[model samples]
Structure formats: structure tokens, C-alpha cells
Target: MNEREILTNYVYKMVASLMQNGVEDVVISPGSRSTPLAYAFASTKNISIYRQVDERSAAYFALGIAKAKAKPVVLLCTSGTAAANYYPAIVEAKYARVPLIVITADRPHELREVGAPQAINQISLYGERVKWSAEFPIPDDAPMTLPYVERHIARGVSIATTAPFGPVHFNVPFREPLLIDFQEELPKQTFRNSLVGQIAPSQQAKELLTAVINETQRGFIIVGELALGTDLQQMWAFIRKLKWPVLVESLSNLRTNVPEDCGQYIVSTYDALLKSSIFKQQVAADTVIRFGAQPVSKFLTNFLTETLPTNYIVIDEDPMFRDSAAVSTHFIHTAIGEWISELSIENTVFSEEYLLKWRTSEELAAKHIQSYQEIEQDEGAVVRFLIENLPDNSDLFVSSSMPIRDIDTFLLPTKKDIQVFANRGANGIDGVMSTAIGFSEARKEREMYLLIGDLAFLHDVNALIATRYQPCKLNIIVFNNDGGGIFSYLAQSTVKEYYEDLFGTPTALSFADVAQMYEMEYMGIEDFKEVNKIMEPQKNPLRLIEIFTDRQQNVASHRKLWQRIQQELEQ
Candidate 1:
């Protein structure tokens, strides 16, 4: 076989191994150097190929797919900045523990330091952000070429899906004549199944945990932002057995997915209640056990930090310390599922009065929120309405800044079995639209809803073009507050001299024209009543719902709500 034929065979086997090991979706940004991979994935019947033009958007698009599917999705791009565009998504995947396979096609070794076109130092480009990195050798006619590439593919997938799952970098260097239109049959070879490592606490550790549980009278469990579809059912059942009050973060999905009876134990409105000194004092926990990543609500974090519980234990699978408070008495590094399954609920029960305090506080806060909703239709109200009205088994993608904070503060506990997603790892406003679209495409069965800020929508506006081809049940509700509404509440807002230009950075662009250009169903909603029509289930695959509000008033409304909560809780 010629060198090109050898390369083609190696590529086919690598692609086949990826498919064999749970990589179903591949996102390709068209380029010459990556032609072999593009064509190989396209021809593979089991792999679904998505073509994206912008490399940056494509990377986040793949991140969304991986997040929704809870598996590794592949991304391929040409050399130079095309691979660089994958950096942001790689950082997100690393912190969020989402599995992604990033393949960057590079120039041959001889081209190094030669100032070749579309060529830069691609080795270790992603640095420590990736779980593993390797330079896949150029394809050769040697006998070992096929086995090497095949084994590399299998190992990369295994590393990505393992606990502490994240993106893996495979910088593939290809020699000239890379665009050859060669097709070859994949050899039938036995493949090893990916191995996952699991650890449970030692007998000594379990005994310590049992002692801690038995001694605590007033304790709480905080479920923070979790990996997509990380099964919390067993953990929830364990919490139920312990009968402790639970605080479910908005992105945790537990707040939305728990059964109605579970509501009596869930403190979904603690974000609002914690702002009240009276309520915070009344419901303080002696012990606090946390799972998953840090909670998104600043109030909850501050409350835990100030309370300084006697026993603060964190259960995390990753090695990184998620606690910013530095108040943790113990950090248990073990798989959450196994830890919860093995936790022995001895003859110990939490105080009913302690649990009742949290339930009453949540109920009181809910009443205040409901009253505010009846009177106003601001951004917070819009957030509440979206959460309350989301269809069962839906996917809700919230953008960072104000949108995610609003959902965390205002979203009430419900029995809805919806999956909530957000890119809170890096917490940047970039790539909101593309990420949501990719998520929608991955979950075709569920209706997808996106709550995004206008700036976030405009930052990744080009992603809208994708809907024209990969349309799904996507309803984008853009809060067009004219500027960075979150800035209005920040300390910088007090410095009015430079706030408008530097912090606010308002963009007066209208999405109506863009909507028309994209042939999307657009609705300009001024009255709160009109949102009902936009949110209702529609056969149309893509729709944009724009709601305009004043940034100044948004901040004022938020402050007023907090003040109201404080007053009600004090009463």
C-alpha cells in the first residue's frame, strides 16, 4: 500500500474504534489538513457528523453535545488558530468534567519553525487543561502504524470518560498530500472495553462518617451544580433515609426533578431566604454535607462561610478543592454514587424541628415571591415563569451573568423532571447560543429552552445560522435589557461617570433583522401576557422571544425583592 493508502487505513480503524467506544457525534470545522478525519467520520455509518464553520463556535457546540449525552464527542479542526479556538471549550470541559475528544490536524515535523502557512507550535497547546495529551505520529506504510493509531483512539476515549472526566488532546501531525480522497476498509480487530475506576471509603473512613452523622442533630445537605444526568436518585433516596433538610442548586436538577413529597425537605428558595438575617439565624445547620461543584448562589455560599458549621464535609470525585470558604472539616474524595450507596443510616434521625424550620422558611419565602410575581413582570418574574411553565422532560440551558443568578434565586421547587444545563465552569458569556443549539440537537426528544442575556446572545450571534440546518425544538428567550444588566447591581454602577461606557457597554442592535435573515420565528414581547404565546409548545423548530426591560429598573427590582424578603422573614 502507498503512504496515502496506509494513512487512510489507519484513519478508518481509529474512527471505527471511536464509534465502538461510545463516541457517536463528531463536529468538524472544514479544512484541508483535517480532510482525512472529516471524510473518515463522514463515511462512518454509526457516527453522526455535524459541519460547523466557525472553529470557536464548533468547539462549544461539541461541548454541549458531550454535556447532554454524558459521553465524549469528537472535534476536529485545521492547524493554527483553528485549534486555538478549541481552547475556551477545553477549559470549560476540564472544569465541568464533561468528556470531549479534541483532534487538531497539524503540519509535519519538518515544517516546525519554518513559518509555514497555517502552522504553529501545536504540541501541548492545551497545556494542563486536558486530562491527557499526545502527538499522534504521521501515518506510515510500516506495519505498526495501524495498531498504534487504533490503540491511541481507544485509550483517549477511556481517559476522557473515566472519573474526573474531561477533554483529551490528540495533536495529529499529517505530512503533505493530506487532502487525498482515499477510502479503505477498516480491519476487523478486537477492542478492549473502557475501564472506569471506583473507590469507596475504607472501613475506618466509613466509621468516622457514621459517627459524624449520628452526632449531628441539625444538619443539611447541599447539592450543587452537577454533571449532566449524573444520577442523584440513589443519593436522593439516601438523603430521604437520613431525613435531613436539602438545598438543591438550580443547576443541580434535583430542585426540579424531585417528587412533590421531596419538596417538604428541599430548600429551593434559600437563595432568597439567606438574604434575610432572621431566616438565616433560624435555620442554621450544625452540620453541612455538600456534593457536586460549588453552588451558584452567592447568598448560600456566604451563609455557609459565616455560619462555620461544626462539621462541614465535602464529597467530591475530583481532587480539586471546590470549597472557597475553607471551612471544610473533611474532604472525602470518592465517587458520589458509591459513597451514597454505602452510607449506613444507623439508628440516627435528624430533628424534625430543624427540618421544619427550613420548610417553613421556604414556604414563607415562596409566598413573598408569589406576591411579587402577581404585581410585577420584571426579569426575575420572567425567570420564575419560565421555570414554572417548562414542559416535563425539557432541557433548559441558562446563560451566565444575570440569567443563571436569577434562576438560582427565583426558581421554585417543582416535580418537573427537566434537565438544566449551564456553562458555569468558566462563567463567560461567550458561546451561549451555539452551546444551547448543540444541546438541543443531542436531546431531540425534549423541548429545549434557553434563557440568555442580550449581550450573550449577540456575542455568539453567528451560532444562529446553525439553526437553519440542525433545527430542533429550541425556544430562545433573550432578555434585551440594552446593556449588561448584571453590572447595574455591581459596585461599579455607583461610579456613574464611567459605568455606562466601561461596564454597561450597551449594544442597541435589534435581533429582529437577524431573525428575519435567519428565517426564524421572532416575537417582540413587551407585555408579560405575550410571553405565554411564545413559550407554548410550537411545531416551529426555532423561535426567538425578545423581552425588553430597563437595566436600571432591573437592579432596582432585584433590590426591592430582597428587601421584601427580609421584611417578610423578619415578620
Candidate 2:
């Protein structure tokens, strides 16, 4: 066979292997060196292709798809700085445990280190951020090339989907003929059959569970962001039977869709009540069973440390040290679902009086937050309003920094089927808009809403192009505080000299102009009266509603809201 034929076979095998292993979606950023693979993927049957112009936005878009589908999404980009642009999403996938198959094209070995254009050391490029990384040999007529490509692709997919799933990288270098110009007919695709298995929890897991139930009277379950495919129903069942108060984080997607039966044990407003020293002292636990990643609430983590629960245990499938507060007494390395399921069979319930204390505090704090909404028109009120009014079966993707922090602080628990998502792995504000748009595209049938700050929205303004290409209905609510409003609550707000220039970083541009540029419908919200009309179902596919606020008032309102909750808890 000629070199072109051999290379075609290698590329075909790699794509075929990914299909066999169940990868269905590919996000491609156009580039020259990746022509062969790009055309191959585009023409392939059964795989969906999503094209994004910006490489950085494309990577995060892939991350959102992976997050929503709970499966691996492949990302294709050209060589050089194009591949480098994928670093932010790579770090997020690693920490967030989202499965991503990142493929980048490169020049042949001879082109390396000779001042070659668009050539950089592609070997081990995304070091430590990816679960595995390997460079595929330039396709040739070598006997082992076909089989090696087949096996390597299968292994890469396996690692990405296995326990502690994460991003994996494969750099494919192509020689001169980056296209199969003359194909007699496409080679019949071949597949590699690999059986993946899981290790069940041993009897020791059960024994440890018995000890936890027998020794501890006041038990608490802190549910942070769960891994993909984590059944909230099953978790709720366990928590209901265990009769323990569960502090569910916003990203856990647990604060909503709460069953009426389990509502009493679910403490959704802990961030409000936990601010008061009296409330924290009143509701301390003897044993804490934490699950998923760290909780978003700094107040909850500090409460965990101050209480110093006797048996503070954390169960995670990944080996990553999630206990940043340094309060875990035991680390159980196992699947959270499996462990919780086994523990449920014991049918042990903790103190109802302890649960009642949490219930009372949750009730009081929620009422205070609701009342604050009636009288106030601040960022906190906006968080509550958006969450409380989200369309049924829709998803809410909140930006990091002030947006997510506000959701954690004031958004009350509900029985609605609204799913909440955020990029909390690295927790940067760079790709919030793109991530939400990608998520909406992935779940095309559902309406999606993005609650983002001005800076985050401006950071990814280019992502608005995705709405035109993918055509998903996204209700973008921009809290245009004119600057980094979260900084107002930070220490830098007191730094009179450099606070406005450095930390606040105010950008006075009108989002209405931005909306017009994208041809998206724009509405400027001047007061609470306008929010109701904006919340009505939008006619256009992409709608931007800008809610303007004062940075100083935002900080003061949050402080007053916390103080109000404290007084209510005391009452």
C-alpha cells in the first residue's frame, strides 16, 4: 500500500475505535494540519459534529457537552497555539472528572525544533492535566502502524471513561499529504473489542458503615457536586431513611427537584443560617458523611472545622484530595452511589430532634430570604428570582465568582425539576457563556438559562456566535454591576489606591450594543418591575436581559441579608 493509503487506514482506525467505545460527539476548531481527520470525522456516519471558531471557546464547549451527556466528547484542533488554547478546559475536565478526548494535529518529527512555523513540542503537552497523553507515530506503511493506532485509540477512550474519568490527549502528526485525494473507495472501518469492568465495594465498606451508624448519633451528609450519572433519587432515598440533614450545594443539582417526603432533611439555606455563631453551635453534628467534591459554601466548610465532628468521612471515586479544609477523619476511596446504597440497607435513622433543629433553621432562613426579596432589588434577589421562576425541565448554568456564590447563599430549595450547573472545577469565569451555550445545544429540547456577571459575559462575548450556528434557546441574564462586583466584598475593596483599577476592573460598555452586534434581542432591566416581563418566555432563540446594579449596594445588600437571617434564626 502507498503512504497515503496507510495513513488513511490509521486515521480510519482511530476514528472507528472511538465510535466502537461509544463516543458520539466531536467539537472541531478548523485548522490546516488536521485536514485529514477533520474530513474523516465530518463524513463519518452516526457521529455529530459541532464547529466553533475560537479554539478556547470550542474546548469549553466540548466540556459542557461532556458534562451534560455524562460521556466523553472529542475535541479536534490544529497544532501550535491552537492546541495550547485547550489548556483551561483540560484543567477543568481533570478536576471536574468530565470525560474529554482531545485530539490535536502536528507536523512530522523532522519539522521539530528548526524554527518551524506552527510547530511546538506536542509530546506530553498537557502534562498532569490529562489522565493520559501519547503521540501517535506519523502514518506510514509500517506493518505495526494500523494495529498500534487501533489499540492506542481504544486504550485512550477506556482511560477517559473509566473510574475517575477525565480528559485524555492524543497528538497525531501528519506528513505532506494531509488528505486522501485519490481514494478508490473508503476502507471498511475496523473495530477493536475491549471489555471494561468495575470493582465492587468489598465487605469492609459495609463493616465501616455499621461502625459509623452505631458510634455516631448526630449524623450529617454534605453533598457537593456529584459525578456524572449520580442518581439524585437514590441519594435522596438514603438521606431520607438515614434521617440526616443534607447540605446540598447548588452544583449538586440537588437543591431543586426535592421530593416532598425528603424536604425536611434537606438543608438548602445553610449558607444563610450558618453565618450566625448561635445557629452553628445549635446544629453541630457528631459524625459527618461528606460526598462528592468540596462544598461551595465557605461557611459550611468553616462550620465543619469548628464543630470537629468525631467521624468526618469523605467518599470519592477519584483519588484527588477533595478535603481542602483538612477536616476529614477518614477518606473512603469508592463510588459514592455504591457506598450510599450499601449503607441504606442497614435502615439506620439518626436523631429526629437534631434533624428538627436543621429543619427549623432552614425554614426560618428561607422565609427571611423570601421576605428580603419582597423588599429588596439586589443581586441576591435576582438569584432567588431566576431560580424560583425557571421553566420546568430546564437547566440553569450559573457563572462562577459572585453568581454562583449568590446562588449558594440565597437560592431557596424547591421541588422543581430545574437542573443547576457551573464550572466549579477550576472555578474561573472565562468560559461561562460558551459552556452554557454548549450545554443548551447538547440538550437541545430543553430551555437553558445562564445567570452570569458582566465581566464573565464580556469575557466570552465571542461565544454568542454559537447561538446562530447551533440554534438553541438561551435566556442570558447578565447582572451588569459595571465591574467585578464580587471584589466589593473582598479585602481589596478597602484598598483605596488600586481597588477600582485592579480588582474592580469596571468596564462601562453597554450590553445592549453587544446584543445588537450578535442580532440577539436585548432588554435592559432598570428595576424589579422589569424582571417579571423579562422572565416571560422569550420569542427569540437568543435573548439577553441586562440587570444593572451598583457594586457598593450589592455588597451592602448581601451583608444586610445575612444579618436579617441571623436575627430570624435568633427569634
Candidate 3:
């Protein structure tokens, strides 16, 4: 076996090991250095391969797949700047706890520091962004080479898919003559690996938590964005017995698919209810049990900080340091399943007066919100239209900044089945389109809709190129306010001189031309005329729906709604 044979066999072992470890998809960017692995991935029978022109978009695309499926997906790119392009998504994957198998094809050790083109020090390039990083030894025909490579792939997949899941890197260096003979038969290996994960609690811990729940007269369950496999039924069962309200965010994936018995006590309009400092103090809980990350609402943050609870327990399976509010009295390391079984077994459900207060507030606020029958101008109104129009079981990907803020404001936890997602880890605006495009690819049967702002839409406009090739349907509803709409809600909007130029950076590009360039169906909606019709899936895979809005009006509308709700609740 010579150099080509060594590279070919090594790539084959990697492909086989990855498949055995349950990796079904890999995203690849075109490059010469990565030809060997890319070829082998394409040739493999069980693996599905995706090709992207840009590395940045490709990485986010992989991140989206990993996030939606709650499984490890592979991202393969060439060395040099291509590997650098994956930095942003890797950072998001780390904090968001999404599993990604990052593989980069690098130049041989001899090529480094010798002024070789497309060659640089590729060792540990991603730094702390990845969970683990290792450089693959140069390909060899040694009898031991195949075994070590298989172990390497298995280790990478296991580490990535484990608790506190994140991206892991493996740099593969190859010499020249990387070509492989397609006619030759490849060796079939039987190597396989498996991993199972769950964080159960001690009996004593469960008893202590049960005592806390039973003793508290006033309490609330705070749930934010949780990873895959969170037992919502168990959570709701516990809440039903405790007779406490649950504040759920859109990213919690709890806005939909909720059991009606417990759904009656679920509070999704807390962002509005908590906005009033007076109400925040009035409805303060004596005990607060939080799960996953904090909800995307500053008012809710203020309520948690200003009205500190006596017994606040933060629960999560990941051991990473949380409790950003600094008010958590205890942190529990257990999933919702184990403890809920012990605590939610009460024969009679308590009818706490506190739950009545929450239900009343939620109803008043939601009624005021439903009064808005017109949405031709206001950006926030778009959220209401979406909540009302989007088909059941649809996937809604909200962009950071204004889009998610509005979603946190308008979305209600109910019996519908809408799943919401966002890049809230770094909270950056880049790659919004690409990530959703990847999601569309991941769940091809479900209809996908992206709620993005104008500024965020242009930031990753290159992702539109993917719409041409991706076989899934994507409906991008971009709120074209001509600039940063979120800044309009901040104090900086008071600054008239530099507001538009600095904080409110406007990009005046025609989205219709964008649709033309990408060859997508275009729809510019001014009003909610047959809004449900627009929400319906189309024959074309890609569609762009642009809504023109005034940033000032949008902010005013939000403030006005909050005030009206406050007045109604006060009355």
C-alpha cells in the first residue's frame, strides 16, 4: 500500500466509524486539501453529504442541523481561512450545547512555516471554542494506522454528544497524491460504539425538593431554552400538583405541545405582566424553580433580581456554571424526569390564590394583545400575525435582537405545536438565514419560516445562495425597517443626530432584487390579507416575504401595548 492507498484506507475507516457512532450527515465546503475525506463521504452509502460554497454559511448550516435533530453532525472544511470561517458557529455551538463534529483537512507538518500556500499552524486553531481538539497523525500504511483512526472518530463523536455537548475538532493532514481509485473495493469494518446519557437525582435530593414544593404557598416555575429530551409532561405534572404558574419562553419549545390541564396555568405573557415594577413586586414568588437558561425578557430578569425569592433552585443537567442573576439559593444537577416522578404524585391538586392572580393577569394582557386587528406598519404586530397564521407543527426560527424580543412578547404557551429556535448563545445577528436553511434541510417534511429583521437579513445574504439548492421549503419573512429596529427601543434612540448612522445602521437594499438574484418567490405584504394563506406552504422550496415597517412606530406600539395591559390589570 502506497500514499494514495494509506489516505484512502484512512478516510474509509473514519467514514465507517462515524456511521457506526450514529453520524448520518456531514456538511462539506469545496477545497483541494479536503478532497480525500469529501470524496469518501460522498462515496459512503449511509452518510448524507451537503455541499456549500462558503465556509461561514456551511458551519452555521451544520450547527442548525445538530441543534434541530439534537444529534451530532459533521462539519468538514479545508485548512487556512476556511477553517477560520467556522469560528462564529463553533462559539455558538459551545455555549448552546449543540453537538458538532468539526473536521478540517490540513497541510502536512512540513508545509508549516515554510511559506506554503493555504498552509498555517492548524493545531488547536479553534482554541476554547471547541470541547476537544486533536490533530490526526499523517496518513500511513502501517498495520496500526486503521485501528487508531477508528478510535479517534469514536472518541470525537462520544465527547461531542455527551453531557455539556459541544463541537470537537480533528485536523487531518495528508501528503500529496491524495487521489483514490474508485474502482478498487474498499474494506468493510465492523467497528461500532454507543453512548447513553441521563442525569438522575439522589432520593434525598428528591425528598428535599418535594418538601420545598409542598411548603411553599406561592411559587412559580421558570423555564427557558432547554436542550433536547426535556420531559415537558413531567414538568407539567409537577406544576399541576404544585398549583404554581409556569413562565415559558418561545425557545423553551413549550409555547406549543402543552397538555391542556397544565396549559391552563402556563403563563407566556409574563414579559408583559412583569414589565410593571408594581406588578413585579405584587406577584413575586416565595419559591422559584428555574430550568435551563434565563428567558429572553429583561423585565423578567428585573423581576427575578429585584424581587429575590427565599427558595430559588436552578436545575440543569449540564454542570457548567449558571445562575447569572446571582439570586439562586441552590443549584440542582438533574433532569426534569427523575425528580418530577417523586414530587408530582399528590392525589389532590392545591388551588393556590397565587395561581389565580397569574391566570387573571395573563388573560387581561392576552386580551389587550388580541385587540390589534391591523398589522400593516408595526413590526411587533408581525409576531401576532405569525402566532395566528403559522400552521400547527411548523418550525419557526426567530432571529436575535428585535425578532426574538417580539416573540418573547407575543408568543403564548398553548396546545399548538410550533417549535421556535434562535442563536441566543452569542446573540449575534450573522448567519440567521443559513442556520434556518440548515433547519429546513434537517426536517424536510415540516414547513420552515424565519422571522428576521432587515439588518440581520442582509448580514447573511450570502445564505440565500443556499435556497437555490436546498431541497426543503424556507419562507423568510423579513421585517424591513431599513435599520436596527431594536435600537429604537433603547435609550440611544433619543439621540437624534447619530442614532441613524451609529446604532441604527440602515442597509437600504431591495429584497425583491435579492429574490430575483436567488431565483425565489417574492411576496411583499402590507396587510394581513388572508394571512393564513401566506402561511401555507408553496410548491417552490424558497420564498421571500418582505414587510416594510417604521422603527419608531414599532417601539411606540410595544410601549403602548404594555401600558394598556398594565392599566387593564390594575383596573
| Candidate number that wins on lDDT, 1 or 3 | 1
Over 1-571, each residue of candidate 3 has an lDDT whose tens digit, in order, gives: 6777678788877888888888999999989999988889888786788878889999999988888888899999988999999999999999888899999999999999899999988899999999899989888977787888888888889889877789999999988887875523446665555666777877777777777777777788888988665666777677666667889888987778887677777899998888776778778888898888888888888888898899998888776647877998877777778467556445233446678889988988888777654622376666887887778778999999999988888876667778899998888999888899988888877878999999889889888665555565789989888898888878888889988899988877659988888778888876546444566557567888898777788877888888888887776
Worst 10 residues of 3 by lDDT: 342-351
Winner on TM-score between 1 and 3 is: 1
Give per-residue lDDT, candidate 1, residue 146.
Answer: 72
Off by over 4 Å in 2: 181-191, 344-349
TM-score of 1: 0.96
Candidate 3, superposed: residue stretches over 4 Å from native: 183-191, 344-351, 374-377, 527-533, 536-539
Better of 1 and 2 by lDDT: 2
Give candidate 2's error at residue 501 in angstroms: 1.0
Candidate 2 residues 386-503, lDDT tens each?
7777778888899999999988876677878888899988989998888888888789888788999999998998787666566667889999888899888888788799888998
Cα lDDT, model 1, residue 363: 88
lDDT of each: 0.83, 0.84, 0.82
TM for every model, in the order presented, reads: 0.96, 0.96, 0.96
Candidate with top lDDT is: 2
Itemize residue pairs with steric clashes in candidate 1. Answer: none
